[model samples]
Target: MAQITLVAAACVLVLSHSFLPGVKGTTFTIVNKCDYVVWPGILSNAGVPTLPTTGFTLQRGETKTINAPTSWGGRFWGRTHCSQDSAGKFSCLTGDCGSGKLECSGNGAAPPATLAEFTLDGAGGLDFFDVSLVDGYNVPMLVVPNGGTGQNCTYTGCVGDLNDSCPSELKVMNTDGGTGGVACKSACEAFRQPQYCCSGAYGTPDTCKPSSYSEVFKRACPRAYSYAYDDKTSTFTCAKADYTITFCPSPNTSQKSSQGQDTETTAATTSPLDFNSTMVYEGAFEESGASPSILAHVFRSHAIVGIVGITMAVRWIF
Candidate 1:
């Protein structure tokens, strides 16, 4: 009888500690490393309480930390070239939340902006995060898990800027009259076709085939959401831990340069047949000749509107 009572007391203690303040939430440290000012924006999922301030100016090399509940799910992106008018109306040239005010409040970033998306404490006690270009590419973003217990709690994000390589048809210029590429639009967002958006008849992964535009995105950010059905290799899982999201993290010295060449003799090329047909199909997609460049990089470190995934949003309402 005494042992049973002691066990009950221990369980109660555990439960209490789990619900204690400062112990059941995730912390996000957002750092802006761009040359210009980046107006950072935050939007929580519906019914999920928002952070202190949804939008704020993050100067060059500035960093800010925000707290979120344990099971909170939302996204963050950097809005560039922002300003306030004489009447105190706020707006950004890129990654704008369309609030007409400095505070995004509960509004998510418009499409075409690079996104650092997160869903903490999800299935199997794992947190899911991804850099999404499905909406389009804006500023380069990276999600680095801080102390955590898991095998795949590794860094995941679009390491290199994608605006530079953005196809002509998909480039979204800076609203402030900047010359360089501000954001790269997803094919779906750019064209809104059933094939690109993966809607209607193209709902499943098997049906929604990768197009030329999507191929570029898939090859660039292999670990990011390139299309609506790009779920198999894009989603990453991690345990409870703080996250560090860096916008335009200083390009690495050896960041896959776009100049290098991979010359190979193909006079008499012969590929071996894989025992597994699935492996062969996978290899074919990989061998589509989308070489590495800055860890799936492109863009000029800016963004505008974008579409994340038109068909594959479960935990997030936006």
Candidate 2:
């Protein structure tokens, strides 16, 4: 009887490990290296499941990690100059999702915000990612892959302080007493012309060429998407890997804070990956154990197996 029970238990374990799809997922470690508070916003792509938290506050030097199921697609950004009014409505000067609260729900970031976009388990089973300045620049961001494969799996982001050098017409100035610039607006947002906006006849990538303004952004951030059609050098991909997204990744940022406060010394930037080094894919939930959502699925799977296994074991014993 004891031997039969052990065999049934072993079979259950094997089956669960072999067929559990929910066990596989990706992880994102978000870090804030800025001198002031940063509110990170997340928006899952339409038709996909939303992440655990859509938005949250991160103090200087703080870090938070979240998990995403395989094939999850979304974008992450930072909100600045946020405050709650007397009516308890939350708002931000830049990168606001317009949810009226910390959580962005299903909303995406407003324009003039730096964005880190991702599509996990995408075409050819690769994770496609990029830091885009196409909507314009509000902060310096870096996205680094951890333990992934493929030649294009590497570091990508915009570390330059574009606000300081932003063109006068494209700069979003701080409304507060400080005269410093807060964000840099894209040419499309500034002029709304067919050429810059890539609309009407310029809708196709062939018709839309990099404008002089986009060139400025490209020169500053070679790996980031500067214009709508800038995909060749901007997009990066990796297979079966987790990611770390850092805000204000530069060791030193000359741009002033959105609150117009004198910036303090910020944290040093992280070291880039050594390509020669070996990478091992440590799955998101595997390292930290299953999250609540994953756990729910895990338990449900086990319950089904448990019932069958026990019934078989009892029949064999009888």
TM-score of each: 0.72, 0.78
1-318: candidate 1 lDDT, tens digit per residue: 665555556555654544444454676778776667888888888767666678888987677767665688888888877888999888876788999998897888888788888888989989988888888877867677777778778667775556766789998876565576777888998888999998999988889988999888776666778887778777878886778887765432122335652111110121211224342222111111112231122111111111122122222333
Candidate 2 residues lying further than 4 Å off, grouped into runs, are 1-22, 255-318
Quality of model 1 by C-alpha lDDT: 0.68
User: Where does candidate 1 have its weakest 10-residue lDDT segment?
Assistant: 298-307
The lDDT for every candidate, in the order shown, is: 0.68, 0.81
- Give the lowest summed-lDDT range of ten residues in model 2: 277-286
lDDT of 2 by residue, 122-221 (tens): 9999999999998999988878888789999987988666776789999999885667778999999999999998899999999999999999888777
